[model samples]
Target chain A: MTTPTTGLPPEPAGRRSWLRDHSELGVCVMLLVLGALVLTDALTMDVDLTQRGPVGPRTVPVVVGAGLLVVAVLLAVDVVRGGRGRAETGEDVDLSEPADWRTVLLLTGVFLGSAVLIEPLGFPVSGALLFWGAAFALGSRRFDRDPLIAATVSLVAHTVFDNLLGVPLPGGPLMGVL
Target chain B: MNALTSLLDGFGTALTPINLLWAAIGVLLGTAIGVLPGIGPAMAVALLLPVTYGLEPIGAFIMFAGIYYGAMFGGSTTSILLNTPGESAAVVAAMEGNPMAKSGRGAQALAAAAIGHFAGGMVGTVLLVALAPAVAGLAVDIGAPDYFAIMVLAFIAVTSVLGSSRIRGLASLLIGLTIGLVGLDRMTGQQRLTFGSLQLADGIDVVIVAVGLFAIGEALWVAAHLRRGPPEPIPVGLPWLSRGDVRRTWKSWARGPFIGFPFGAIPAGGAEIPTFLSYVTEKRLSRHQEEWGKGAIEGVAGPESAASASAAGTLVTMLTLGLPTTAVAAVMLAAFQQYGIQPGPLLFEREPDLVWGLIASLFVGMVLLLALNLPLAPVWAKLLRIPRPYLYAGILFFASIGAYAVGGEVIDLVILLIIGLIGFGMRRYGLPVLPAIVAVILGPAAEQQLRRALQISDGSVSGLVGTPFSVTVYAVIVLLLAWPLLKKAVTRRRAEH
Candidate 1:
């Protein structure tokens, strides 16, 4: 599909970086790694001597592992043949613009930070931080209003989910207050 | 008559004040969340699924019935007012309804949609009441091998029929299958992919996967490409149809469920095709043929009914066969699992009240939706104007709470983040998320069925295709997988001629 131009040199502006052009190869790589992991795990599993069925635990995993490997190879071939996966589009999505990695990374950091802090800080504090940080990450800049709203949202969620709903959430330092 | 008696009893349970309150709350919350610009019915349900976890099973399911209908109505509301479809099913709604909204006929469009929804849902539920029992009875005779074959057929259908790239879809399925394999083998105590972690032994919660993939993944995806500036929701008064509007749309509403339910009842039959079918049928049969592209009310009426009808159809498949053909149905199936209820042939016999009550509430929900939403169309439209930051932040916030609250473990949060990243990657690469979700929910069951079939045949491979039903299902699977290649060859042959 990429027929070379013999007379004129390839235009740099028209060309994308190889990684960007073949970003789907990353999915292929991930699939391959997953396939290998599944296969290794299945092959190493200990089967009891008194197994009743020929279709033991390893059978499905082996088939699924092989399927993953086969699909990874097929996807790679399709990618090399100039077939491209379509980026998902939605109402808010502007695919014409490149993905904003900064927001995604910031949100990821906030999520992980909350996960780490939830046990120590309790949901009210950590959940508020999560909501506020996520809002900030998504470009909400009102420090006063955002924190207040975040706290309200967090407290309500904590109260409803923990106090009312009976999902046990660690209260951290606020263990005795409420 | 027997079905009627069962349905009456179901109403007895669903009509209680407590259950009715849950239904009302589900409808309100489902519509509120679903009215958000980017959230679809599936995501709305997934995000709210945790809330119902603490409730008793019957009340929760009644709530689910309301949420299901409410989210769908909300999706159409968004499609009409903002021309922003939350899911593929609503794309047809946006087609004629958005144009209607643009022309200052937004109220009529909403009226047509709401009424159409009520009509379609009523017909679909009636048919479900009539047919689901018979289907479940027939399903009782299906052997393990046949069941496995059907699962295989489902996998093939979702991967091949729904997505543009079959390979990508298959890859997504494999990813889900791998995730499904994380827990200990049910028969043996051996772990398949637990990696020695205690949390992994229980396997990743379907709620975590669903919320991560649909809610968090979507939030992150939208955040990365947040449409700057607020969405201009079309201003509208109460949704009210004229006599002529009703006369024109009533037949289309009748026609839509007949078209939608059968498609939804079949394995791998989704709402998308039926919606398009209804729109085209309405166009071909309409007196106002030229008005189709120019915002004809029939276009809104037919497809909205069809989408609603298909939702009912999806429930039929889910309840009778334990097969979920759409993302929302899959999540609902997961909800059943969360309640330790396996929705299959035995479900009708095992949980009559739960099943009948859920079915009964569908009828009740339709009435409630029409009554509540028709007067509140303008209010629902206002929900579209919420700031993108706060809207998406709330999604992540609730998503965190839901995931964490599932097992109440910090590890679930970590797993949620990982799944969320994978989901982000999936959207970036254009892989369909539905197939992965369906695979995750059904993969373990499929494996168990295959093993059971094989065990019965004493390790013989022929055991997989031992039954007539299994044979037929395998044949369909072959045809489905080969369909694209066959199409390519036929086109090439035509060119040669």
Candidate 2:
């Protein structure tokens, strides 16, 4: 039978190994790791007599840690029982297409690159690169138009946010040149 | 009568030229972004939240009220023409409106939706004006225990009511709670998960969590599966209803608010259920049974009204109890907290101008929406033709600006990217993002309330259930948890018969 709830195409029975089928196990593992980290942190935390109530700072974290562990186990059980989650759908999302990892990776790299360079290169130069990089990653190939638009977008953002809105942004080598 | 006078005074405040200008700008920007595929009202508000940093609290909230309502109004345009819902609440509108568009009645469908939205929004705001004060009046007596119980109910309700799997929902919530656990504990000032970072001591900013999750996460997710080529929007002439169309839709519009407003006021009672209920109710009452699945005006009319009305209803809970039942409400609540304005019973007395003006501005926003957007439908529809690359790139660009603008530090941007990845993972794994956001917003508050409750009773658990209100809330929570089992048992019994 087709998985109506999950909106996934029906899988061939016994064609793939069970391990491959249960890719969601990764999520469970992540949850378990997080739970352990929280538990370790909460357990090791020092509590002086500053706490007035029986429910001190550690209580909520401990409870939350236990909850994460419980939820991880429960989710693992559900996944093994042939349950599947329906990936989120949106207006731009095409569920029929396999995820484009290259684009996601490129976008991530661009984002991180901007974050690293924002302070040193300033918002205008870095942000312009960020916009162009993201557009290229998303498949905009108009080399002539894209950079022009990106530079314009970055400058406009700088002007509005820095000058108009009065929220300061670093200008770097081009400081006061604009 | 008191609410009426207060509302009138609110109108006086909202009508000031500066406040009106902000409202108009909010409506314009909100609708423009809301019309874009993959961006909903919540994302619009979250992306715009940082820009309001320089404004006073009153203007910011007034603008938010405009944005909130304006986005809902804009969502239907995309739903009707593009056959893609801007948000979950607009799904019902797309069901019939898309069919109507396919049948070459796109304008009629849009007219019905727009007018129906106006009618429902008006009713919901009136009810909000009337009911919010009464609810807040009663809420004044609610102790920390009762508040804690309500928060628990909200958490459980959001988890249980949404998504197919309870395990995934709970897991998402736990992740949010863990994130919320970072920073110095409210009571003892001891770090729970800060890991000795100076920035972590103050905790992750709600602006980061909000923009990172809603805006940046959405941008990344869309980038991964970006649809090739521009969407083909159904062309429509100016939206104008004939006499027959209005005659058909007015009844549904009238009936929709009654169905939508009460549902909106309740905790975790989002627009989805009420809109669905309105659609079903209209289908049942209509004489055109054959058109049930086809392009039915009543179908669009009812659900559109319900959705708008529920938006107002969601605000009721947000204003009266400081509880947010929908994603948009949650982000708006964060916006309130950003300004150090705690919305609840006391807000009515403390910030009457801000509160009342915000409520009155909802009406002003509706007028602006109908007056401007009705003729501007084609302009909004054209927004869909913008290439997916620039749309998503703009989102990331603005998100980065918003995040960095918050603290003027690179660390905030790093945190933003990390949260964006988690958000992307949540979507990939079919985890509902709403619970996570609500948890992030309410987690620390709920923990504080829980501790205070226990402290009042000297660490006895009975303090949690001491009040009748809290006790009743606990009973509801129990019922919410047991519902799935109850439903399964009923189905099995029926099968045996």
TM accuracy, model 2: 0.97
Give the TM-scores of the predictions, in the order they appear: 0.97, 0.97
lDDT per residue (tens digit) for residues B292-377 in model 1: 89899999999888878888889988998899899888898889999889999989999999999999988888889888998878
Per residue, candidate 2 scores C-alpha lDDT tens digits across B51-121 of: 76777887888888888878887888898898878577889999999999999899899889988888999
Candidate 1 residue pairs that clash: none
Model 1 stretches with alpha carbons more than 4 Å out:
A1-16, A48-50
Residue B256 deviation, candidate 1, in Å?
0.8
Report chain B TM per candidate. 0.98, 0.98
Scored by DockQ, the top model is 2
